[model samples]
Target: MKKTAVKKTASRRPRARLKKSPLPFVDPAGQNGLNPEPPRAIFLEQPAVYPGTAPKAPGFELPPDYGDTKIALFAKDPWWLYAYWEVAEPDKAREAIRGLGLAVQRTVLRVYELATDSRAAERVSFFDILVGSTTGDWFIDVGQPDKCWMTELGFVADNGRFFALVGSEAVRTPRFGVSDVVDEEWSFSSELFWKIYRASGRIGAGASSYDVRAVVIESWQESAALQKKQLLLKGEGPSSFQSRGSA
Candidate 1:
């Protein structure tokens, strides 16, 4: 009987919505409305002007200064010498050529052999070479080794007068068949002697031990006789011969 009573509830109300404003009208030809004015333009300020003399025109540049002429020489080998030179100031070279007062056809290289003594003026020999240009290199043949040499670059005048421009330092040629550093004495070791003897084929492949020994003894005796003969031919006295033979 208590479940038969039921309570009644009130109904809910819906909220009210606000309306949006309309957009402005636009013309397709870029004119929003009638009597529209054109847009104004902005520009940067100009540079200031000074009333005075005009700028000068650039002139031609001058030539650069150069160094003096130089010469050098070196020994290429026992019988050859190499010489080279450079003419830095060509104007000076031209002036000298003009001063020669001759029909200059070639540049001349004069080589001289100096004495062993440094302070001596005794020239052993002299020679000349003719070239087309002032600046060049040359390989000279100075025959006979072990000598001091000097050289100069110049031009020969019509009257045969030599006009020297540059000179090189003294250079010495090497000796023949030997180096500057000499050994007092030289000898072969027993091991090296045996190697050389075997390589010389004195003992054949089929030789026995006794046969090898006999061959070696015979070779030693022959070599000793030859050496003694050579010493006698070279004017060795009997005392020296006896001393060497005993040793």
Candidate 2:
């Protein structure tokens, strides 16, 4: 009897996976008090904006659907106005900010577009670096930060220990658009957001509170001598020495 060889057949259909969008209603520690993660901007709701509240984008900026239910924030510093939408269906809330590459801007942050990916962590790093540099200073020049972080960068604490931290998190939308190709007409509907901040900079990561505080204060100032000026203070007004001269 002759032996016959059997052949294997492949299926016509491909593997199916869930189409997941970045978390909908994301509130980084900066503003929206909900999520309270780091990179959260200082968001304070202004008085009833009423009819003149947030302006509408001709095509996508201000959609009529946004409704008056929304109030203007960052009145004094209306920089990053995070937008969110809630769908009563399966009880889901989404951040409609990323779907549209509507271009984020701030008065002082006009120097650079931050033209790369921006999520919570980068924001955290940006803030961390900012606060860590501006301690006790007025104005500072800011720039778009590079996140490829390598070479073991860190801060030196009073104890003479070099403190370094490594952070990781989901990437922000648009900048990468890894999920989908960016379309011109941007809206909150397809917006995608993620948690971002200095991951390992906290106490749990071996960094001291003093170092963290120093970084935070210095971050507010963005100058060339940022760290040098902030970290190394003048030193208690030049330690005076009271000694009698030898005769």
Candidate 3:
């Protein structure tokens, strides 16, 4: 009994570690302290900012600067707009030109529903109008758009003269199924743009898609900027683009 001594051993304990939850972003149940879960912020909770009236479009008569006016944005979020009145005629045409551009400008200033489907029918909540003269290049926008939608309807001359436009800002998340960030350029070639344009019909009534030039569209793994830059240099549409001449 004196020759052998009892050996002592330490008790083992479990270590604390955080693991990925099956429900995503949720902590495992019944762990340590019971902290209440934080609530999510809702964007739709805010009241929409829209005027009660819709600005009227000019009739079939085409003004002198109908398609030639230049719109320059001198500020961010673009508040101050400088409209260059380069009318071809004397006084009356200039007045009509100013009036027409002003009306279009007012409409563009306010956020309009650029989606064709009834607001309730579609999942989309809201949209803003981006009139042609509102941006730098005389199109919707010349750079990559963060979020947006387009509609089949647009502002125009009563004689069927068309005015270019884009829709309001969209909510951002990893949610858009067909959109790639870097693959987006100022032009509409991305799947996101096509889908929105196709559904919304940003094109004016009865206009042909044949006049719409294609831009190099990059897929999920492609570079949108590079493709657009290349298209800009080449003055050609994408490889898959087909001319919708009659259809």
Candidate 4:
């Protein structure tokens, strides 16, 4: 019969749970709390500035009309002329019609071909182009080169008479071929002429110097023969005189 000693244990109690914060916790070194690594950045070279840098150009816009009543003609090429015109306000047109005492029926562009450069010279020929009311520009096909031309913007009256509003200065179209002003005649030596001919590929690149010499000799002989033939045809040849002397 022995008495046993028993140990008493304390009752278990539930612990209180802590609420989570919505904001992220930051470290004193200004780094993310979850990822404690420092932030990284890439550096780039600074740009250079030049002393001759130009300022930005201002925006430019062309007005529809210059508010002046004028017609200008320009020669685009040997056979074409461009004409542009601007009519003043409607009141100006009415005033012009009243001053001329004519009722305008339609607009017209009259093209004139001057015979000479003299201001008092008459027009050799003229043609009319029927341009509508809304036309501001036109391309005229002159079909002739090296000619002086003039144009007038006008209106055909109801009575079939024409009234001019504005006239452009006469412009001369250029010729397509070589200029007529010849200062002097250019003559080249036979050796120089042959060199140019060879350079121009008339003589083949694969030809030897002897071949070039033969070609030049043949060309000279042919030219002399041609000159003799021409003299014989004209009845004034050395061959005819030699034959007469032989006879």
Candidate 5:
């Protein structure tokens, strides 16, 4: 009975100790383990330059004068006429005018105010502009609107004889005001004209007739208020000067 089985406490088996091998020495920055490999070298390909990618050179210059004997005229607005002419070179001019016994002294632009639109119309008046030998262009002020004009590029002789070298075709200027020639089929009355004139003002729907009248009056007054410098003599008003080769 005393031999009571000493409850033998079951001894738990000891766990096996894992002996881990020493860890590899890491870099201070921890980027690589103990034996850090050398860094790799990267290569990049450069783009090729093409001939078309280069900048272009400056443009070619135009000749100042063509060795041709020609003249051109153009109308600028209702007041001015522009004329450009190219005479033959000195040698050519002399050769062409040889045996003419015309001793050229100076260049002159003879502006003729014609009576009609015909190229051979009767000359109503004439004026001369003394352009030096080297002038290639000129501006002529006829000072009369709705007239025909022709210009002649000629050399003035030392003895006052004018030798015409080249003449331009007659060009009629545009009428500055309303044309006098009315169509018989379409009679434009003064009332219609005034109506159109008022409509051109674009008066608002709510604008009264008095407002329209005021607008018309203001416009009329403004037109009448001319500057002293703009006032020409009785017949010296600017004509319709048009360029050549135009209708």
Candidate 6:
């Protein structure tokens, strides 16, 4: 008997298993699964202290603020004066320049010499300086001393017109000669020197005191000699002793 051919279907190919990407490891917050809240920032307010008052604790001090646009004038010497300024608001300065209706070429400092008589009109002098958004201190030779001076910082236009931005308070330049009065009542009194000499003589009557005074004088002389030698070595020229000896 011919048996029907057994039908053997091809074994089905095994299905491919898709591999998933591993998740990143995250640190667990606490024993509980909930995340902990972030810490809040704390700020302690400090009380303001006045100038002469003693503070409970030493605190940081801030520098003085002279407002948006400030100019100051200081006497450097009999002939020179120093001027410094600050521009706090650049936008305001730019707006002022725009209002001038002239192209600014550079920054100009106008120094006005007020009349000593106060009745005469102020004499104006100008100095041109190339400055940027910020400027440092500047020195100007104001010539004569013992005169009142004031300064104005401004922008000089290409058309030679100046737009004054800020002005400084008037300051007096010191005279070249002795401007301060000498206290001759105490300094030139012969009786006071005589009393001091008598007291020193009584105190230095002991041999020990004499020896100490001699030692102090010798030490002072030696230090003076060393300082003179150092100055000479630094190219300050010959000392009086050297000059005399050479002569």
lDDT of 2: 0.31
Better of 1 and 3 by lDDT: 1
Better candidate by lDDT, 1 or 4:
4
Q: What is the C-alpha RMSD of each candidate to the true structure, in Å?
A: 20.2, 36.7, 27.4, 19.9, 20.4, 26.5
Candidate 4 colliding pairs, count: 0
Sorted by lDDT, highest first, which candidate order results? 4, 1, 5, 6, 3, 2
What is the C-alpha lDDT profile of model 4 across 1-247, one tens digit per residue?
9989888898888888898869777667756646555788988797766778757579997787777888889999999999999777745675678687777788889999998764356899999999875238999999899999999888788788877788888888889998887553243367757775785567767556676687767666766787788888988798779888999
Count: clashes, candidate 6: 0
lDDT of 4 at 151: 90
Best by lDDT: 4
Error of 6 at 194 (Å): 13
Q: How many angstroms is residue 13 displaced in model 4 relative to the true structure, after the best TM-score fit?
A: 34
Question: Please, what are the lDDT tens digits per residue for candidate 6 over residues 192-225?
Answer: 4444455466545534556556655655676678
Each prediction's TM-score versus the true structure = 0.44, 0.13, 0.15, 0.51, 0.51, 0.42
Pairwise TM-score winner, candidates 1 and 4: 4
In model 6, the worst 10-residue window by lDDT is 184-193
Expressed as tens digits, the lDDT of each residue in 1-247 for candidate 1 is 5677677786777667667766655555668674435678988697666767556679987444235488899999889999988667655765776775664445789999989634245678889988666688899999869889888898776667777888888888888885657453233347546744665667454545665577666667766787788878887968777888999
**Model 1, poorest ten-residue lDDT window?**
180-189
- 117 in model 1: Cα distance from truth in Å? 6.8
Q: What's the lDDT for all of these models?
A: 0.74, 0.31, 0.38, 0.80, 0.72, 0.69
lDDT, model 6, position 202: 55
Model 5 misses residue 74 by how many Å? 2.2
Better of 2 and 4 by lDDT: 4
Candidate 5 per-residue C-alpha lDDT over 1-247 given as tens digits, one digit per residue, 9 for 90 to 100: 5776778889999999999999787787766746567789997798777989977788998787887777777676577788988776654554445557656777888888888987699999888999875338987886677788888888777678777777788887777898889774345446655665656565433556676677666655554454322554333334322322244
